[model samples]
Target: MSKQKKLRKADAATIRRVLALIAPYRLSVAATLVLAAVTVISTLYAPVLTGQGVDLIVGPGDVDFAALITLGVQLLVTILITVTAQWVMNLVNNRITFQVVRDIRVKAFEHMQVLPLSYMDAHRPGDAISRITTDVEQFSDGLLMGFTQLFTGVLTILGTLGIMLVIEWRIALIVVLLTPLSIFVARFIAEHTYSMFKVQSETRAEMTSLVEELVGNEHLVRAFGYESRAEERFEKINLDLQRCGIRAVFYSSISNPATRFVNSLVYAAVGVIGAFLAIGGSITVGGLYAFLNYANQYTKPFNDISSVMTELQNALACAQRVFDLIDEDPIRPDAPDAKVLPHGAGKVEFDHVKFRYVPDVPLIEDMCLKAEPGQRIALVGPTGCGKTTLVNLLMRFYEINGGSLRVDGQPIDTVTRDSLRANFGMVLQETWLKAGTIAENIAYGKPDATREEIIAAAKQARAHSFICRMPNGYDTVISEDGGNISQGQKQLLCIARVMLRRPPILILDEATSSIDTRTEILVQSAFEELMKGRTSFIVAHRLSTIKNADCILVMKAGNIIERGTHEELLARGGFYAQLYQSQFARS
Candidate 1:
């Protein structure tokens, strides 16, 4: 964990790439562009009409009342037309924006399914969520407000400049000279604002991760008396978030005021130059008035252009984050020609396998194991000796660093992930149930399970009695992670879930380790029934629970030291025997 790499700003190529998402709505985009052009033309007409009104009112001849009324009506008509065109443009722009956001959100989520478990293990849940929600919303605003405004503002600026030249070329030249300076200043502000916004997005994501972790593990914090420590950590992250927010707003707020100041300078220059030209008889007084009106109109589009530039930079920062996630290569699956496991008397073999969660520190090394259908294999090892790691590999949660694992004489890697996982049922030390009825939680794996089948599975796991005793019986709603239930009951519900699945291969990773002695006896009996005809791998520290396993493996460090039946291993007077004596003998 060196500081997570900062995302690059949205460059020209990135903007073009994002715009391509709207390709399917080309018709709507074309309509918007057409309306924008019409709106710009209509907006220019008002200045010309104002100039006509000025000349008529300040007469060198008779004052024409009819001409004044005509100019006034034409100006009113232009305003009405410009407003209508803008309304149409807004509709089209919002439609494209919402559609693109929907597409990107879907693509991001769908791509996540193919990514390996390792990627998820390395990233926080809140960071991933921010990419989907906050990042996508920013993209929407960019598409809608940024894209629409930038396009229309550029067209308006060009159209207004052309009209200004036609009215009085000297004034137009002054405006043109000022254009380059305004653009340069706008670009400078945009660059600074973009950088700050990117930092702010990252800090916000970090803050979200902290909050999600605290809320998800509130029970652990309370149990460990860590509330004060948690609060301190939260305050630190919150302060950092506040600082980033202030910096981003400070940079963004500078663009508008600076653009307005430049526009004011251009307007004052226009008034002075126009007055001189009018007095010198180089231009008509009416022409000078129209030129001034056009100058004011011209500055508006430039102001809008600068604003859109800032928004585009912010949007690009958001898009960069989302694209980074979408570009991650998902774990490669088996080739098309890979072998498929054949139906048989289920057998699992691990040959010379080696693994490490971290490089250079092996958790399991040169390990080999075999179990035929209906065999119960118990793995007995100290806390750090990799019992759960072995089970994880068997379930394909991680790929092995070396060696081979096969099921039914076919390499595990050759089988499709879906097919491989469909053959196993697992129960962990800590059981998890969703916020649903007890029946729904039990029938999760088999969603189409009937009431009779649900009841049967519950009965098999010895959970039916307690479930029946509840107020709602089988329909009792289990709160988040089954919070309404006791630890033993939750384990029983998990047992029922796996039993309902009824896979050929079963794995119990310290499944009985958390239950009381009485509940353990009940669960052990139910487990005995479940293991009758499956190839079962059980990891347990409690020796009594695994005494009847067909093969008992005693492991230390990263290697297995002894392998025998309970009686044979006890008679050998080895580590297994010593561990057994220390526990069962004392009892």
Candidate 2:
């Protein structure tokens, strides 16, 4: 009820989502609560026995050894039972909490796989990692601690209140009257912390992003001598995070002590009131002691729960971010009527295709191109002139706005996305390799590739010699994100991956950009040989790269201004000729 009353509208939704995450673990939760309840009962019995033991003291306040020993044995048993129950309850609670958190993390990762690249483009990968790793842990810790305290705290309060009433109604009234005062103070302090905690969460995420960026590009930062600037940026974010954390903690710090102080006042009132009741012979000394113990017990849960109010609010803020990501609509799945695409002969036709990164900003309008089986198509233009965009469209990475893209006489959209993409191989300007052995990275697209297949592909991509020079050759483990290897080596690994796939169509977007001229010539020769029977789309900034292309579409701005082989474009003395000559002239 306290948690329910404190939650605002936004938190209400997040709380529900978090509860949904726990719904599947209802049996474990129920078992944990049952253990907690047993612990509460065992715990509540101790103070009652303590008061009874006090009742056995001699009239002159001398030690009643024989009776004291008997009571001590009972008290020891109660304490052991209480301790054992709590320990087992804690074990169960932790298991449930971690499993609930793990399930959410797994679901979030699976959702990420189905999300389109457009979503990834709009957000940083580090922020997503924070949601899965940082936020989930925060939520799990709060839930774990919250559950342990909540179950026992509730039972302790209600049990103590009932026992206090049975012991003395007058003292029970004092505790009942002061409970609201403690709650009021806690609520006031906790309300202010919610906003501060929200800010703290955002600041923490910003710091995570900065750390990821700096570590990811440590080489670039040092090469450019930007260490001071990086430190300055980090200090700015770190200070902001520190300030937000201090304010959030400061506000939360006030809540527990304030609640405890209010409850302490009630404790004093109960003591003062119980003494008078005893003096008037209305209740026995034993009754007085039991009521005091019960009154303290009744108020302590409120204090304990108040102590965790700040933690709960911080957890709720994290829960909101994680839920926001979970609630994101994933990329559209294949249509209900979608059919599997047959193996391709690589006949691609772009029929009056229209595309743009953003709507209303026309990039490629009414663009037409046709590539028969075994033809080499080159797209050449300045940066951002829809060269890579064409490759993206052909591979169905982005859906074309106003056209049908067909492969071997079948409309691409009519088939399942998996089958549509399975026929094509791509090597982008940005090469990606995971932390794995050289053989594993090369065999990424085809996990079952034989050792000979892997070595053959590596040799064709010109990666074999360098790979052999490494300590473990194909079995050597690369560092994270392929950072241990050179950029050209990473590119070669990517090329080797594509070569192993041997798809019917290929898209090479400046694949040779990272290598030296000498290495590029060798890699290019391997690619040229590999491209012989596949429909290939090559996007090249270097005009010389397209000299032998079967067809080259010279793009300017977004549209193709000229189309021909290299010789025809030069003879026309047009945009292509001007662009081609300008490169050599500069060199």
Candidate 3:
């Protein structure tokens, strides 16, 4: 939680941006403010009534019972009206604040969908979650508290000062001069606390990320005997949070006491000044008493407002985090007149393509490939030799740096991304199964898929039999990353999801890695059936599986070194031949 030093930026702009979020609820906000004004006015008049009641009993023998009874009723009525007004204000304020937060959270989630993978790679998932949830919650709470403080603080300070000035401008000058002291004290403390509170917020998000990572892979941590190491890391973070949290709280806590001390001085000076004015024949006894009451009331808003400035700083910091998230660079947008791709023969051709995650370290350069409709293309290479990189280019996950790609003779960049991606179905080595019933997960790609179609796809994936054995069968929920089932079972569910899609182009990258050999045979048979009458790209290390491929691509060091059928490459005695021989030797 160490502080990151930065120059304070302009807050007027940030405040305006936050106020814009509240603009939509102006009607409710206006109504709330009206009620708040009534509450403040009622509260400010109570002190004057007390002065009148005290004046009615000027001396021990000069008491006025009739006037005292009437003043007492007036005081009680004012209190009841203030309470009612405040109650209504709370309801409207809560409604407006909650609605604004709901919109902000929804906007964040929607923006998430359009952001590029590069952005996500740069930030932690838990940090993003904290911004949308915890940060928004903090902002909402701070705003609600600040609402009442804003109305009451301003009105009380101004109203009390006006009354004091009307009674005696000499004492009013002293109160005015002393009031700025409380503001200066508040400003100095708030500035220091701002940095500390900001650090605490960042540290909290980091802690949340660490916890999510550790919990998500608890089995991995235990398997590698890394529990003790994880605990050590968490303890370090926890201690940092404690140090930062204490400093931030301590700094903000002093503002109230420091301002109160200044307020007490103002009170003493006013009391002494009012006594002289009372004795000088310039003010009545009742006027002197009321002036003292107004002086105290004037300073109370100063203290309350200082405390609220602390809340305001926190709210601004949290809001900046959310705005930063919403401000991330989004994915490359479609062409202005981008059109939906027309269904055609799936002929994919890569022409002098170039790509690399890093600018200088080229991973794929001057690559070329051409596949006909219904052809089974297999890409075989050692890990990190650009097999996945090539597939990533085809799916448009990473845009090629230099050259263009075409599908059915149309440049892919000329069409909309949704249309291009909708034409392709993918199943990766890493399986993804969201939380839902088995049927729902399977029908993810094809939302309108029928029950019979789902069962058919599950049967082809060799998952139907096991699914029926579960207590709820296809209706069983796959909770928490599908941890309730076996990894192989999860992989099968992913395959079933893709099978239900039945798109024109298929990309299977190590699609059968986790399955046992017996299950692999069944899954391969299913893939053979699914690949018929479709253009397919297969990335596999198991050379045996690609023996019957229409064409095999042998790649190394970002270039295709060999290309042929299995028997043809074996006869050539090249890289692919050596790779096949090494596998056979090991077996």
* Best prediction by lDDT: 3
TM-score of 1: 0.92
RMSD after CA superposition, every candidate: 3.1, 2.4, 2.5
> How well is each residue in 1-587 modelled by candidate 1, as lDDT tens digits?
22222323236657777878778889988898898898889988877888888888785677898988888888898999999999988888888889889999999999888888888989999998898999889878866777578778888788889998887888899999997777887888887777777777788788888888989889899999999999999899889888988887887778888888999999999999999999999888888888888888888777887788788777887887888899898887777877555445679999999898889776787999899888999999889888887887887888988999988887788887777887889999978989999999999899999999999999998889999999999998889898888988999999999999888889998898778888788888989998888899989888888889999888898788999999999999999999988886864
> Each model's TM-score?
0.92, 0.96, 0.95
Model 2, residue 432: distance off in Å is 1.2
How many clashing pairs does model 2 include?
0
Question: Which stretches of model 1 miss by more than 4 angstroms?
Answer: 1-10, 59-63, 339-344, 469-479, 581-587
- Best TM-score among the predictions, by candidate number: 2
Off by over 4 Å in 2: 1-7, 61-64
Write the residue-wise lDDT of candidate 3 on 1-587 in tens digits. 22322425534556788899999999998898789789888987898898898889989899999999999999999999999999989988899889989998998999999998778888889999988988899889788878878777888888888888877898999999888899899989878877777788899899989998999889899999999999999999999999998998999899999999999999999888888888898887887788888888889888888889888778877887888889888888888987889666789999998888889897888988999999999999998899988887888877889887999887888888888888888999998888899999999988899999999999999999999998899999988569899989998999999899888889999899988899999999999999998899999999988888999999998999999899999999999989988999775
Give each model's whole-structure lDDT. Answer: 0.86, 0.87, 0.88
Worst 10 residues of 1 by lDDT: 1-10
**Which residue ranges in model 3 land beyond 4 Å of their true spot?**
1-6
For candidate 1, the lDDT comes to: 0.86
Weakest ten-residue segment in model 3 by summed lDDT: 1-10
Clashes of 3: 0
The deviation in Å at residue 198 for candidate 3 is: 2.3
